[model samples]
Target: MSDYIDQTHLQIYNSNVWAYGNSKWLGYPILKYPCDLFLYQEILHEVQPDIIIECGTFNGGSAMFLCSILELIGKGKVLSIDIDPQPNLPTHERLSYLKASSTSMQALKAAREMITLEDTVLVILDSDHRKHHVLTELNLYYPLVTKGSYLIVEDTNINGHPVSPDFGPGPMEAVEDFLQSNTNFIIDEEKHKFLITFNPKGYLKRIK
Candidate 1:
């Protein structure tokens, strides 16, 4: 088990250092594993969600990617939020940006207003990976995820999914904590079929 974990860690390190550090998703730097990107594509196709709420808007590459998928799906909107302003966010008819912390009450209120009761919402928490912050975000946004959709928590591979062992409690830990009391959501293992992803076990689907 230890040996396998070590090897996986090295692969994750290489993917982060080489692939994510040196690539772009649709002309925008996207610091995400390619496998994870594929997973997102698959999920978007399968869910055909009405709205996607991305908690972190790093460079807006991922938002652009989602918007492109929405275009292909012929509908949907991307509401991306970040604590800091991104000057060069990708332009898209389906994309909206909000510069605010994902867990802030004001931001949450605005997000709720954007979501209609009939909307099938998907949320991605990629900002502030600290356990507390992720937990707060989960509590704040999980409700937006209608039944049969997803609430994805990115970067769970860090802080010892064998990468960044000393990075402290992050997305993975937060997930463990949240799942204890949350029965409506479960880890969708099929989403990890790619075998190499930055968000292992982070694909949570709402079954209720």
Candidate 2:
């Protein structure tokens, strides 16, 4: 359940009970969305940032995927945060975690010290789902991520549409707000099809 965890660890998570062609994670358990692995690899190659900041750590599977890539690269790591600690703790020489409210600047500052100022950093926003909550998270994380890096938001669409049962406010709303105001960020419409979700969200990579 530490840094060495690999693809073999993906077990038959409750959701995948009936699914076939079951891919596995070598060490960690729990299933994740399809884009998790894809985006992790894409970011590693395209952005190749020095520090990766993740807002959520549910089950630690996704973080393990990202951290594993960093380990393979030998120069990057993760500063992961969560309000509740997952029972399956994520470990790797490069992974550092914090158990605190992501909206707090104090917490982000503490995590900030772990990363270099000039090293490109990617911010994966997955902490809270509320519109205001996600918006607050973006405000805090946006400043830290390098200009060319990314601010990845997950679970934007809960049920295929804004009218979906679980749909309310989350990454989608927050990102929408940011885009309307910021001239530097651009939505990678070309990457739209790469997403697999309710309605799916596009990559809003920083261009300025």
Candidate 3:
């Protein structure tokens, strides 16, 4: 675990994630209600976006949690797409699960059909970690996101192994590819770059 996440009291929540779409069992088992929780709450309270698209719904934990925030805010929905929907089952009324490959144009089209808002705010990329795969996913989703909204790409590094690039190429490498053209979406290099001997990439904003 990185020092930042480790020292942040994430361990307080343990791994007991609520099925109420409030949150999930992701992150350290202890820091379940860490900063990420508050951040999501703020996003809900302030941005109040009507649509959220989250790719790579591993266990639906993260997706459900964010959706619950939207639910509490009185509106908004989450279109969480995953190639494999057999992970941890999620409970969310505002969540619409789509089982399809994130890299597929067909799948993207299907996801678009499920959205209720044209000006979507958030796009969380936690799907296939391969560089090419992340790049492909970015190309399609980035354009759909509203300007000033967030585009969070999770697991920038594989666990604690920053040097070990398990992703065929990686989301980090994919960022390099993306910068070739879409430079307007600048990386908050300090925030996104992992500091704990590992590089867990996180991104924000797809458009300017």
Ranking by TM-score: 1, 2, 3
Which prediction has more favorable lDDT, 1 or 3?
1
- TM-scores for every candidate against the unseen true structure: 0.93, 0.81, 0.72
Superposed by TM-score, candidate 2 places the C-alpha of residue 88 at a distance from the truth, in angstroms, of 3.1
lDDT of 3 by residue, 185-206 (tens): 8665544333331223455554
lDDT score for residue 127 of model 2: 71
Per-residue lDDT of model 2, residues 55-133, tens digit only: 8876676678887877777778888888886786758788878888888876788768977766888888777777788
Evaluation by lDDT, superior candidate among 1 and 2 = 1
Over 79-193, each residue of candidate 1 has an lDDT whose tens digit, in order, gives 8999995677788999999988898887888788888888889999999889999999998899889999999999898897868888899999999999999999999999867
For model 3, where is the 10-residue window of minimal lDDT?
A: 24-33
Model number with the top TM-score: 1
